[model samples]
Target: MPTTPVVSRRRVMAALFTGVACMNIAMAGASTAGVLIATESPGPGWSGVPSAAGVLGTAAGALGSARLVVSHGRRRSLLITYGLGSFGALLAAAGAVTGLFPVLLVGLLVLGLGNGGAQLSRYAAADLYPDERKGQALSAIVWAGTVGALAGPPLIAPAARTADLLGLPGLAGPLLVAALVTAAAAVVSAALPRSIPDAHPRTPETSGSEGFAVAFAQRAVRGPLLAMVAAQVAMVAMMTMSAPQLHQHGHGLDVVGWILTAHMIGMFALAPLSGRIADRWGGRVTIFAGIGTLAVASAAAVAAPTSHTAGIPLSLFLLGYGWNLVFVGGSSLLSTQHRKLQGTVDAVVWSTSALAGLAAGPLFALGGYVLVAVVAGVAALIPLVALTDH
Candidate 1:
């Protein structure tokens, strides 16, 4: 049976803070690639390593989550996530200091595994609320992370400079700060109420692998999953390429930081209320609106990279906001569809999104910004069309 609706604002705040810490650490790993590629010529083909690390981490985490979903359950899995992530952050920092690419790869892989697990933690947040308000709870968790994402780069900036002063690579300093963030997340995770154990209540009709199979085969699950998969690819591709896109157009890293912050603001600022829209309007309506927003954002980005005058920031902001809507809506739908089999559905969602992102990076590199934006826009249109037709 579903739990009571006891998610007070205070509890929501606490949970959001916990999630934010974990997300901050997870996202900080991504900046490592940019830092590495910029600071050191890692030779040709190595430019993609950091992004690969993130993907690999996500994959590992997803797989681990799958195993835990069947075995120890969600809460225990998250505990392992924070614990391993803390160690991975430390190891990555050490590898950066020593300039050991191999070690860095290993460390990042561990971090990625942790990331996969942390991603599922958002679902745990949703479970804290009642079915009617699950989307709102999920959005609150995402919104909490928005602050960390905005501040993430600056957090490591000073450390990077200090590392440079101390005759160490700047990546070293950022890794250290990331470690602290991970540790903090671990402490927060410790505070989560353990009242509800990992697995949802099982029944003859909705238990085990058979239940998962049935859910996936259903038409309702398919629509949301398809929409979610496409939206994830576009959002990840745009965000991944933003730095390069900005750089090519004569904007510095600082500008990229500001743009990212604006994007975060766009997503987080509206999150509190966006989920409520899902509650009132249904996920399908919100999903279409979200995709439309992304389509506009993508078109704007493709048409004008040099035009940073309000338009660029506004476009990116819309893009971010659109992503939040799609994610929240898609997730809400999944929760509704799977109900008892949420953990399994979440695994599929994360895996699909990660695979899409993994594919997006190389596509962006080969096709460049214009082509990538077009691809993302086209992809966004698929969901829009589907939703409109329905």
Candidate 2:
């Protein structure tokens, strides 16, 4: 067994983390304004665009992942993903200028592709370190995304200002910023050590090629997949309604912003540690904790906003943290379970998640806030029951 080049576990983790966050910065900005832009040009049709775009992105990402795994390999695939991400940003900026809804949709689709691919690349974080520390490393890489996540919406303010100068909405500015972040991530990837798939040539466990069927059959992979899908769907469903829900309860947009910021803060704050816990205790425990937290949070939200402004934010924060924990924990497990099928399994997982979001989005939009939250909360618990038998 050849020893991997020794690097600062912390530095490698940090670099990957920055790399992941940078990839999404643009999309994050666009997401902040997605509904508004949709409503402006397309009217109510815009209401469905975000979730639809999410589905397209997930599908594209699945295809992109397979291609990356086959041709460029993991490291190069990440670089390609970064480039695509940046191009998506540029495309989005252009759409904002011309008011071309189709072009905007196309750009969003491409951005989705990049998002799918960049997120899948996080699984490769396990490759950068020895097996023993893999979970922690994966968590660290994901934790880095928190930086971009936080920056995504906030960056919109300045971006909006910049776009206004160009006679476009501020939305264009964030796309430009996203492009810059993607470019930077690509540069960093160029410096990374080559990525080795979990399945090595010498290992008997290496199955070589993993078609969709085999990947789906694995319990370890399936467990986290369920967790990811549920958590993600719930998160998006809740998030989509955050502004309205807060408003219904008499909270303003500023208060809504505070809730979102707090949610993101909770998500990243515990990620690295969660990763370490996954490494120490295993993915199942962390996932269990995450699912439990989400169930509780959902119940709190269903209870409705109270006089305590902090309650919703606090619940959302826990939701974010719980989501982060489950995702990283599940991702780590999936990486190991189907080493040869990493990309395939990832595609399946994310695509399933995307579809779930697609189904949940409008339902939430039409169902109103409380129903969506309750349904998502209740749904998250289903995986817990099904997977415990394993």
Candidate 3:
């Protein structure tokens, strides 16, 4: 159920785009920094911990945001989520400064919450448009990540340099920048026009474990849910391992950064086109394309060594676009669902991705990147069987 807006749809949409871009920039910087920062700690392995924490936080945030929207509406939900994101960033910075992995992980978790909020902004965009235009609306918000993709990696060096000069951890700079920008993102949340409240606010009886059970019980919800989860699991598992894989192969942060940039571009740059495909050819076709590309990406990763010039980066790029397809396709499938389901769907997706993140390290350790890629390719296939004309 969407609330009627007092303001023009375009104004609200612009704010959503801007707010998403800001979150992406912060996330991009923090992701690299988090990896580098975590590596500094001495332990059995931090590979899965940081990404897992962030993703878990994302799952929590997604769930919380949906319930919040049901009662208070989208704008209020955005405000709360971004605010938590900002505080979480600062907490992460403190962790960096004190050389405490626990603190850093906690901060990352909170920051993930904010990111989770940003992720659902696409659904907020969905409320403004009709079903016919939902794909484009979702894509417009998703494409905003391209800004982060291009701008984020470049900031790593300069932000780290600033940190070094400030006598802080070299990697702390990006986290600090993340903190600042996420704060701004919270302010941007205010720009979203207020939503007309649902006729009846969701009571605890209708919104907790019972609520989720009811929503998940619907047969129509299951297909898109599986597709969403598959994309996230495959993408997150491969991605969580990519940086460490590169570092192990003697690639520097600069190379890792460049590769990530390519990956982000693939994830976001052509979102409009993907959205159009969903709109024109239908989400089933769009989802098929995503699943196919993910398989190819996995095979590509296996076909060549990490050092191969184009193999890893190009594979990652395809992987990103593949995730995009499923993401857009999945969301578009839900355009007709009760808006209450958006948050839960996103929560499930991120939650599985968190598990995927946790699993990547062990999988890599056992059979190396090949095994992880294989796992991802296999996950993509699960949804293919469930997808229908919808």
For model 1, how does the per-residue alpha-carbon lDDT over 66-94 read when each residue is reduced to its tens digit?
A: 56755765556766876787687777777
Per TM-score, the best of the predicted structures is 3
User: 1-390 in candidate 2: lDDT tens per residue?
Assistant: 535545544455555666778765655666545544664556532454654574467557756765675666656776777777678767876887777877776776777676766676666667655667778777776776677657765676677787789787666776677678777887887765574534122332455566656656777667778787778767766665564455456654345545666777767767888888888998888898888888888887777645237667777887788788788778778765444466555556556555544554466557665676787788778888657865
In order of appearance, the predictions have TM-scores of 0.85, 0.87, 0.92
Candidate 3 per-residue lDDT, tens place, 44-111, comes to 15676788888999999988987787788778988999999999989999998998888988998999
Please give me the total number of clashing residue pairs in predicted model 3: 0
Cα RMSD for predicted model 3: 3.1
**Native-referenced Cα lDDT, model 2:** 0.67
Candidate 3 weakest ten by summed lDDT = 196-205
Assess candidate 3 and give its TM-score to the true structure. 0.92
Q: Give the Cα lDDT of each candidate.
A: 0.66, 0.67, 0.82
Question: Which portions of model 2 show Cα errors greater than 4 Å?
Answer: 8-14, 194-206, 243-257, 305-308, 338-340
**lDDT: which candidate is best?**
3
Question: What clash count goes with each model?
Answer: 1, 1, 0
lDDT ranking of the models: 3, 2, 1
